[model samples]
Every structure is written in structure tokens, then in C-alpha cells.
Target chain A: MNAIEFHSLSKFYGKHRGIEGIDFSVSKGEVFGFIGPNGAGKSTAIRTLLGLLHPSSGSASILGHDVVKEGVQARLKVGYLPSEVDFYPEMTSRELLEYHAGLYGIEKGEKRIEELAQYFELALDRPIDDLSYGNKKKCAIIQAVLHEPEVLILDEPTGGLDPFMQNRFFELLESLNKKGVTVFFSSHILSEIQRMCDRAAVIREGKITAIEDISSLLSKQMKKVRLVLKKETKLSLPDGFQNHHSTGSKHNFDYVGPTEVLIRWLAEQDLVDVVLTEPDLESIFMNYYQR
Target chain B: MSMNRTLYFKELKRNRKNTLIWTSIVVAFTFLILSIYPSFSQMGDQMTELMSSLPEEYARALGMDEGTWSSIIGFYSTYYGIYITLLMGIFTASTGATIVGKEERDGTAEFLLTRPMTRSTIVTTKFLALGTLLAVVYSTQTFFAVLGMNVFGDDVLWRHFVTMHVHGFVLVSFFTAAAVLFSSFLSPKLNYMGPVVGMIFGSFFLDAIAKATEQVSWLGYISPYHYLQLQAESGSLEVNWGSCIVLMILSLIMLKAGHARYLKRDIVG
Candidate 1:
């Protein structure tokens, strides 16, 4: 059985759609990514599986247990890191972790907690209210992994982490995956998802637009090309290039063809300066939506 | 340890300050009000004359029964006891209203509900924790009220003292359960002061209106205060099993229905 499965799972907040007909599955030991922009229902899908939001129709399950019917059992081996990690501010990190450890029925989690804290450079002794956003995020990371759950579900988990901590967190997740832990990572950041996931699902307007292996998805990566013409010249675009918009002497468009072909074309054109950058997830996502 | 026990302790720790503050307010109020009993009792005939001069309906509405003013337990029950019940009702109602909504308001609902626990279990544990906190507050207030009367008023009836606390608990439980019921449906902003204050004071005024206007005397039956007042007039601490059972059953119904709604709620935060 899959580690996580959603069968036509949908949630509606009154008349407003939270997530509609969200269907996906993550196999055991796979780091599956969920990519969507804000209000695109990434958090809604994650929260439904976690039993924080009840589905308006259909169902979901984790570890072969129904999320709604046997929610406690479904969550028995799961760890969740919410997008907004707000904790009891008055309590020290140690106190809050101890409280969570008790909830997960973890006896003697201090050693594991301390190890994660050290990895993330978390100040575990300070009160959580006094911690910076980054420090609080580190604390969130530590608490989530201390129990070493069989499945990890993170919604925008790396938002407040520094580059170093983000790398360390990825390494930790990789190790955990190696130990057969399944992960469901949700974020609007496409590159992060590409960097971490084996497979990814792109959602928009509460609907799944695409689900593909990371390698194939990366091949479809769109590069935004901006060229400054040395002289006033009318340039004709190629068949594979799309979203070509020219302003004055500068031209910007998304290129999906081979880099060698683009480089050859650029060499032939009278170009003063040229810069090729990766288009953000929004533009890429918009292309998918239009398709 | 189980999730419910862990959550219960966490909730208790969170409510520790609130419990202390509310309990102190009720206890202090009880002490302050009962201290006036000494002066009133000493006036004797002058007090009776003073009472007769006041408008009868106005005085009764203020909980001053002319005949009961001379007796220590009677005066304490009519004056301080009624207000103690009101304060306890507010305390319990606020506690019930905020306990669940606050989690959602502060974005901690995701943290707590995502644990390996069912929504039912979470609600049950929180309800138990709130019940435990109110129990502590009520018991402390009772202890202080009894002690205050002994110190200040003198000649206090132990039965009335004990009965008043019992009655206060039942009345507060009804309001608290109602608040929990409301909290499940309303957002945090609406749940806090509005429903609780409205229900407690609304029912209170209804009871007062029923007493003042003969035609609406049936209105008293709709308010928990009327039942409390009825039992308070009976003059014995031997549990008024009728009202106690009714209030307990109604509270249980509210709690069960509330839990069902809470289980199905899609937490916005």
C-alpha cells in the first residue's frame, strides 16, 4: 500500500474552495513534493491529511489508515511541520519539546532532541517567545524529527531557515528517507522541490495540474532570456520559444529548447548583452495552467 | 503516557495564571461583601426601619429579602452568594470559550491537532482540563468564602456555606457548557466575551424580569439562576438532587453535541 493516498479528497470552506478533488499518492520511502503558489491549496491538502481540516467530500489516508476514520492511528507514525510554526512562547524550547515528547509517548527523547538542536544550531535553553524567526524554525525542526517518525509532512518548512540550516535539513531528510521514512514536502518554491523531491505534483486553484518524476520535470525547466540589441533590428522568434515580449531594445521570452541551439542563435544575433535566468515558479505554473 | 493526559497537563499549566487570578477575584469579593454583614446585623431595629422605607420591589430585585437580612446565612446567601455564582459563571464560561478557540487564534491548532490524537480525544481532554481548573477555582473560592464569613460575619451556617458552593458549581457548569457549545460554532472573536456575557447576563435579567412582572414569572423557569434561587430559599445544604441532576444532564448534552461539532469543524488557522 502507498504510504499516503488521497482519493478525490476535497475541502470547501463554505462556498469557497479550499482544495477540490485533490488526488495523489506517495509510496513508502519516497520524498514527494507538493508545489503550489499561495492560495493554490498546498496547505489545505496537507492539513486535510493531518486531520486539521475535514474534507467536504472523498477521503484520505496515511500509512494505510484512513485519516478521517482512524485519524489517531493514521498519525501514529507521522511528524508534521506547519507553515506557520507558532509555539507556546512563554515556555523554553526544552519545555515545549518535553510536552510534545509526552504527547508522542517518547520516553527519553532528550538525546535525539539535543542532537537535532545542535545540527540546526538551535538555542534550546531560551524561551520560545524570545527566539528569532529562524531560531523558532530550528526549534520546530528539532521537535518534528526527535521522535523519528515513519512519515514526515512539512508545509513550507524551509522558509525561515538560513542556507546552512536548509542544507543540513535536507541532509537530515535524505538520511531519514534512506532509513525508509516517507516524506511529503509542500512548498511554493519550485527549485527547493526540484532539489529535494523524487516526484512532484503541481497544484493550481485547488486542482492538480501535473505529477511527474523530478528528472523529467527538470528537463522542462524554462529559462527566461533577456537580450539587449546593439542596434535597432527586428528579431524573429523561434518556434520553441514562448511568451516573447520586447520593450525598446530589450527582449524577454521563455526558452525551452536545447541550450546549444539558443547559444548558437544568440551568437548569430547582433546582441550587446544577454542574460539567461530561470523563470520563477509562477510563470512556469501559468504556462501549465494555460495548457 | 496517553495524549489526553499529556494535553491535560499542558492545558492546566497554561491556565494556571488565569485560575489564580479569577479565584482571587471571587474570593476577595466574597470576603469584602460578607464583611458588611456585621454592620447590617448590628443595626437591628434601625435596619428593619431602613429596609421598610425602601421600595419593596427595588429591594427584592437587589436580592435584599427583608426578613432574611437579620440572619447571617440568609444575608450572605442573598447578597454575596448570588454575586459569587455570577463571577464563577463568567469565569467558567470564559475558560470554556477560549480554551479551544485560542489554539486556533494563535495558530497552535495545527500543532496540537496534528498529534496522534483524534479530534474527539482532543476535545475531551481539553474539556476535562477546563473542568479541573474550574473545580480548583470553585473549591478555593468556597474555602475562602467560608473562612471569610467565619472571620467577619460570625454565626455562619455550615450547611448554607456548603450548599452555596454546590449551587454555584452547577450554575457555572451550565454556562460553561453553553459557552463551549458556542465556541464550536463561532469564531474566536465572537466566542470570547459576547456569547458568555450575553447568556449569563441575559438569563439573569430574564429571571429578574420574571420576578418583577407577575405575568412572566414563567420566565424564571428558563434561567438557571431561578433554579439556584429556588434551592437557595429551601435553607438546607442537603443537595437539591432535582436541580443538580437537571443541570448535569443539560450540561452533558451540550458537551456531547459540542464535541460532535468540534470533531467535524475545519479549523481555519
Candidate 2:
């Protein structure tokens, strides 16, 4: 069974479309990424799937339990970390986690809470109101994983963490995923997706535009080519090359298509120096948006 | 009655301070009104003359009559309906409105709704908490009022006091449900005190005006206060079981409607 499924699920806030025809499923134990820019229905889709918002049409399920009809069962196996952390300000981190554990009927969460608190370097005694954004986020992270849920649904999970803390969080996620935990990671940051996702679905304006494998997506985009020819010679570029420019012995352009064809073409040129750079995920994400 | 104990307790603790403060106010007012009854009782016919001198419409609107200064229950009933019920209603009804809505207002709905519990469970647990808090305030004030009556009045009139309290409890419960219903339809960010006070005070005055004016007596039918009489006409006061049951039924309906609304609500960030 899929860890999570949204079969033609749609949500509308009256006439305003929140998410439309959002069809996708995450495989068990796979790290699946849901990527989009802000207001692109990423959070809307996440919220709907988590049963926070009712689906206007169709349905969603987690671990084969219907999110709307069998929401308690569906949510039982999943842990959700929201993009924004807003805990009860009166309670300390310890109290909030203990309360969360109580709701889940966890009888022995105090030890787990202490261990996670120690790991994250978060002060468990301080009120949530007094904690910094990063500290609060750490607290959120602790709660999300405290139950050791089978599925982790994270929306922009790394937002307020410093680089070192982010690194630790990613390591924790990696360990959890290795334990056969499925992760549905939603974020606007391309680099985070590139690092954590095996495959990613790109959302645009409340619809899924494309779902691409990380390696295949990287390999399929155009590469930036810069070369220093032996002399400035007039050259007829091939079909896959565009935006060619030359000055003295230097030539710069972009290449898309078969790497072997480019290699063969480059072999024919008298080159003194050559440089080929793969575009970052950010550029590729923008490329998808522009397309 | 199906409830999450964790959430129920958390909610009660959350409103504990507010409940304490409001309960204190009601308890203090209960004592003050009971304590001054002796002075009024000492005035004898002078008090009766004073009550008689007031305009008929004004006396009717305040639920005050010549019988008001005669006994502890009558005098206590006057202020109990106007001030005590309003005060307690403001606290419970306003608390009722904010209990679930506060999570939404503070952007914590995402966290709360995402829990393993269903929305129905959350609503049920929250309402249970509101009921518990209401009981704390209502019973505490009633206890102090009973104590005050014993200390201040010779006859005590326990039966009349019971009748007044029963009616007062029903009135406050009705308003509490109304607040929950209103919150489901209105924005969570609203300062519920204005609308809550308006609803409670509005009902009181609507019933009062209807009593004061013959042409608009129909208006009293719309107010819950009219059905649930806080003060009696003569020294003998009877608990209106029919009105109490009907208002309680309506309260349940409003509460059920609010619960249904919350179940389908899009808990936005």
C-alpha cells in the first residue's frame, strides 16, 4: 500500500481554489518531495491531506486509511510539522511535548522527550513564548518525531534552524527514513528538495505540473558550456546549442541533449581550455516554472 | 460525553485564572447584596415607599417590586438576574466562544487539528472543558450566596434561593451555547465580550422593555430571560421547569450546531 495517496483530491475555500485535481502517492519508505513556490498550493495540499481542511472533491488517505472518513486512524501513523510553529505560549517545551504524548496515549514519553531535548540542545524548561524562532522550531521537530511515527509529513521543516542544526535534523530524518519511515516533504527551497528527495512533484497554481526523479531531473536539464578555442573561428553551432557568444579565443554557450554528441563536437574543435557546468536545482526549478 | 481527558484538563487549566477572577466577582457581589438586605429590612415601610415611588415601567424593567425589599430571596433575585447572571454569562459565554477559536486565532489550529484525534473529539473535549469551567464558576458563586444568605438573613428562604439559582443556571447555559454558535459563524479574532455582553444584556433589556411596554410585550418572547424568570412577581417564586427544559434543549441544539460547524471548518493557519 502507498504511504500517502491523494486521488484527484481538490479543496476550495468557497470559490477560491486551494488545490485542484491534486493526484499523487508516496511509496512506502520513500522520501517524496512536494515542491512549489509560495501560494502554489503546497501547504493547502498538505493541510487537506492531514485532514485540517476538508477536500472539496475526491479523497486522500494515509496508510490506506481515508483522511476524511477515518481521520483518526490515518493520523495515528503520521506526524506533521507545520511550516509555522505556534504552540501554546503558556506551556514550556516539556509541557507541550508531554501534552502531545498524552493525546497519543504514550505512557513513557518523558524519557523520549528528555533524549530529544538533549539531542536538539533545546531548553525544555523555558516557556514557548520566550523561545527564539529557531528554538521553537527545534521543539517542533522534537514533537514531530517524538512518537516515532511511521510517516512524517513536513512542510518547510528546516525553516528556522541554523546550518548545523539543519544538518542534525537532516541526519535524524535520514535515520528515520532508514527505519522504513515514509517522508512526505513539502518545501519551496529547491536545495532542500534536491538533498532530501528521491523524487519530487512540482506544483504550480494549485496543480501538479510534473513529478520527476531527482537524478533524471538533474541529467535532463541544459548544461552551461564555456570553451577557449585555439583561435577565434566562425563556428556553426549544432541543433541542441543556443545563445552562443565568442570573443578572441573564448566561446560560451548552453547545451541541451545527448552528452556524446557534444563530446564528438567538442573533439572536432581546437580547444585550449574547456569548462562544463551543471545548472543548480534552483535554475532547473525556475526552468520548470517558466515552462 | 465522549471526551479526550488530556484536552479537557488542558482547557480547564487554560481558563482557570479567568474562572477564578470572575467567580470572585460574582461571589463578592452575592455577599454585598445579601449583606445590605438587613439595612433595607431595617428601613421597613420607608423601603416600601421608596420602591413605590419609582416609575412603574422602571420597576418592572428592573424586576423590582414592593416584594423586593421584603425578603432576602426577592432582593437577591433582583440583582442576581441583572448583575450576577450577566457577569457569569459574560465569563462562560465569552470563554465558550474563545475556547476552540483561540487555537485558530493564535495560529495553533494547525498543531491541534493535526493530532491523532478527530475534530469531533476536539470539539467535544473543548465543550466539556467549557462546561466544567462554567460549573466551577456557577457552583462556587451559588455556594457563597447560600452561605451569605444564612449569615445575613433570618428566614433564609432556601426554597426561593434554589428557584432563583436554577433559573439563573439555565439562563447562563443558554447564553454560553449562543456564544459558541456565534463564534462558529463569526471571525475567531473578534473580541467576544462585546457580542457576549450584547447578547446577555440585549436579552435582559429586550425582556425588560417588553415587560415595561404593553405594545412591545411580544419582544419578551424572543428573549431567553423572559422564559427563564430570574425574579418572581410575589414573595412565592416557583421554578419554571418547562422554560428551563426548553431553554436547555435549545442550548444543546446551539452547541450541536456549533460542533457540526467546527467539524467541517477549514482550520486555516
Candidate 3:
């Protein structure tokens, strides 16, 4: 069964486009990634799915319940972590979690909250405002997952976490996914999406460019190569190269072929300088648009 | 519709400090205002003669329209009433405006909207909490007023005093509702307090202008202050009933509009 389904969902802030024609479904237990640059409508689509924003058109359902018409029911089995976490500043983290647990009717979730807190190394006694950004994020994650929700929708869920905490968070998500929790992860971090998602939907400028399995997505991946030649030279074009340009012996292009082929070709060029880097999601989307 | 009890208490707890502060302000101000009644009464005819000699507009501005300063009821209505209404209006307006909008302003709307509760429930819980806080503050105002009147003046007219406070509550309810309505459309960058203060003080100014000028007298109908002042002046149960109806209708309309706007709002931070 599909854990989540969005059918041509669109949201506009007055004349400003948020997300348009957003359609996809996350199968039960699937780790679905929503990859886009900032202001590319990934958060908009997720917020609409959570019923935080009403869609201008179309609909979304979670666990077979309509998010708009039956948001309460849809959210009963869903856990959401926003891109930026903020809580009642005066309340202690423990108080906030207890309050959330009460809302979810998880009477026995105290043990789970404690477990999650200990796992995240979060100090539950401190007020939310007193905690650092990473600590606040830990509190958010605990509240989201304490109910053992069937679906977890996270928007940029790991921004402030240290490397150790981030790895621990990933491990926790992995275990939860193993237990049949569907995950909808939204982030602009290409590598994080690549590492964690089974399938990813690429949104750019309020529209979905592609929705494909992670393996297929990897195949379409493009690396940006920047080289500064000692002098301007008429170089033979490489088959994998596109968007090739040279300015005063400085040349750049997106290479889609094997890394070795690009390296081999570059070795034969005039000696100067070269830099290889993974292109951001926007640049990749631009490449996809060109194709 | 399931009402989340946890959310209700959390909202009440969130507003606890604010409620205490407003309550204290009203209580302390009541003591300060009513304490002067003894000195005010000692002057008696001299004070009345001096007050009546002032220009009619200036006297009206001081809330001394055909009311003497010697009697506790007259003094209470003339001076204490204005301060009480203004303070309560500000407190209630600020409370109502911030109750829902603060979550969005602080970027906690995302945290709140994701919970297993409907938007209607969220609105109802917060609105009810605001109502509760207002009730607590008004009760303190009434308590302090009664205590002050008994200690500083002759036998307090308990019935009239209670009725006055009930009328004051209605006036504050209108301001609170208007504030909440304004908050629904306001940007987070624009603090709700500014608009609340503007609306409360603007209406008071309009109420004063209506009192001073014959041409814009109809403007009095638009101000909640006028409705409240009518109740204070009449001191009739029938007038109080009519005022209650008007205030209730106005408050309900604003609340309904705010609830609808809030339910449909796109919470982005």
C-alpha cells in the first residue's frame, strides 16, 4: 500500500508560485527523497502534504486519508520534522515532548522519549531557548518519532547536527525504515539524498523535473570540471563534455561520462590547473533541461 | 472534532506569565486609582465647582460629563473606568493577537500543524485559552475594584460595580476579537502588538472625537469604547443586555473571520 500520495498538488502564495503539478507516491517503507535547491518548492510540497499550507489545486493523502479533507486522520500515523525547528522557548525539552506525546495519545511514550533523548544525547531538562541549535534539533526529532509513526516526513532534518549526531540520526532512521516506516526526506544536499534515499523526486522552480529510482538518478549524475590552461589552445572536444566554455585559458564543462575518461582526456591537455566537483542539484537540473 | 487537551493546557501555560503580568498591572493600577478617592471626596463642593468651571470639551475629555467627583460611583465611572478599560483592552488585544500568530512568528507553526489535530481544534484551543486568561484578568480587576471601594469610600454598590465590570469585559472582548482578526492577515515581521495598540487607541481617539464634535457623533457607534461608556452611563440592566448582544455579535464575526483565515493560511518561516 502507498503510505503517501500527492496528485498534481500545487500551491501559490498570491502570484508567487510555490509548487506546481507535484505528483508522486511513496510506497510503504520506502525512503523517498525530495531534492531541490533552496526556494525550489521542496518545502512547499512537503508543507502542503502536511496540511500546513492549503494547495491551490489537486490533493494529497497519507496512509489512505486525504491530507486536506481529513488532515487529523492523515497525521495520526505521520511524524513531521520541519526544516527549521522552533518550540515554546520557555518550556523544557522534556515538557515539550510530554506535551506532544499527549497530543498523539501516546500515554506510554515516556520510555520512548527517554530512550530517544539518551540516544541523541539531548539534555531534556534545559529550556528550549537555552539549548543550542543541535540540541533543539534533537528534541524535534524525538517528538516526531516518539509515537512510532507509520510515515516520517522530514524537511532538511539534519542541518545543525554534528557529524556524530548526524550519523546516529541516519542509523535511527535506517532502523525505523527497516521496521516499515515510510520516509519522505527533503534536502538540498545531493550527497545526503544520494546516500539515504531509495528513490528521489527532483523539483526545480516549483515543478518536478524527474522522479526516478536512486540507481537511475545516479546514472544521470553530472560532475563539473573547471580547468585553467597555460595558454589558449584549440582542443579536441570530448564526447562526455557539454556546456564547454573557455575564457582566457580557463575552461569549464559538465562531464557525464566515466571519471577516468575525463581524467585521461584532461591529462593530454596543456598543463595548467584543473578542479573536479559534484554539481549541485540546480546545475544538474539545468543539465537535464539541456538534455 | 477531537480537542487536544494537551494543546489546550500547553497554550494556557504558554500564556501564564502574560496573564500574571496583566492581572498585576490591572490590580495595582486599581489600587492606585481608588486610593485617591478619600482625598478626592474631602474637597467635595470645591472640587465639583473647579471641575464644572472647565470647558465642556476638557471636562468630557477627563470623563467628567455631568458626573461629580465626591460620590464613589461617580468618581469610579469618571476616572477608574477609563484606566480599567484601556488597560484591559490592551492586555486582551495583545493576548488575542499573539495566541495564534506567535507560533507562526516564532516558526513553531510547522511543529504545531504537524500534530495529530485539526486546524479547527488548534484555533478553538488557543481562542478558549485567551478567553480564560481574559476572564482571570477581569476577575482580578473586579476584585481589586470592590476591595478599593469598600476601604476608601462609603458602602459600595455591589450590584452596579459587578455590572460595570461585566460591561468592561464585553468591551475588551471586542478588542481581543479585532486583534485576533488583524493578526490572521499580518506578517510575522509586523508584531501584532503594534496593530492591537493602534486599533485600541485609535478607537478611543474616535470615541473622544465623537464626544467633542457634533458632526462626527455617529462615529461613536463604530467605537467599542462608546458601547462600553453607554453601559457605564445608563447602568441599566436592559442597556447592559443590548450592549452584550452587540459586543457578542462583533466578537463572533471577527473570530469567525480570523478562524477561517488561519485555517487557510500558508505558514512559512
- C-alpha lDDT of all candidate models, in order: 0.83, 0.91, 0.83
Highest TM-score model number: 2
What TM-score does structure 1 among the candidates reach? Answer: 0.89
Q: Model 1: runs farther than 4 Å from truth? A: A220-239, A243-286, B1-3, B152-155, B230-240
For candidate 1, lDDT tens digit of each residue in A1-291? 999999999999889999999888999999999987679898889888988888999999999999988998888889888788899888999989988999889989898888878888887899999999989888888878878889999989998998998999999999999999999999877778878899988888999999888776556667889999988677888767887888888898889878788888999998899998866555666567666
lDDT, candidate 2, B1-269, per-residue tens: 47898998898888888998999999999999999999999999998999999999999988888878788788888999899999999999999999999999999888888888988889999999999999999999999998898898888678888988999999999999999999999888888889999999999999999999999999999999888778866676889999999999999999999999998788867
Give the docking tier of candidate 2.
high
What clash pairs does model 3 have? Answer: none
| Candidate 1: residue pairs that collide | none
Scored against the true structure, residue A142 in model 2 reaches a CA lDDT of 95
Clashes of each: 0, 0, 0
**Which wins on TM-score, candidate 1 or candidate 2?**
2
- Candidate 3 residues A1-291, lDDT tens each? 599998999999999999998888999999999887778898889888988888999999999999998898999999888878888898899999988988888788778888899999999999999999999999989988999899999999998999999999999999999999999999877677877899988888898888888776555578888998899887687788888888878888878878788878988988688898866655665565444
lDDT of 1 by residue, B1-269 (tens): 12388888889999999898989998888888778888888899888788678776655555555556676777777755457777888888999988888888888888888888877788888999989988998888878877877787766777766676677788889999999998888876564876678889888888877777778889988988777652234344455779988998999999898888887777777
Worst 10 residues of 3 chain B by lDDT: B230-239
Instruction: Indicate the residue-level lDDT of B10 in model 2.
Output: 92
Give a tens-digit lDDT track for model 2, residues A238-272.
88998798898899998878899999999999999
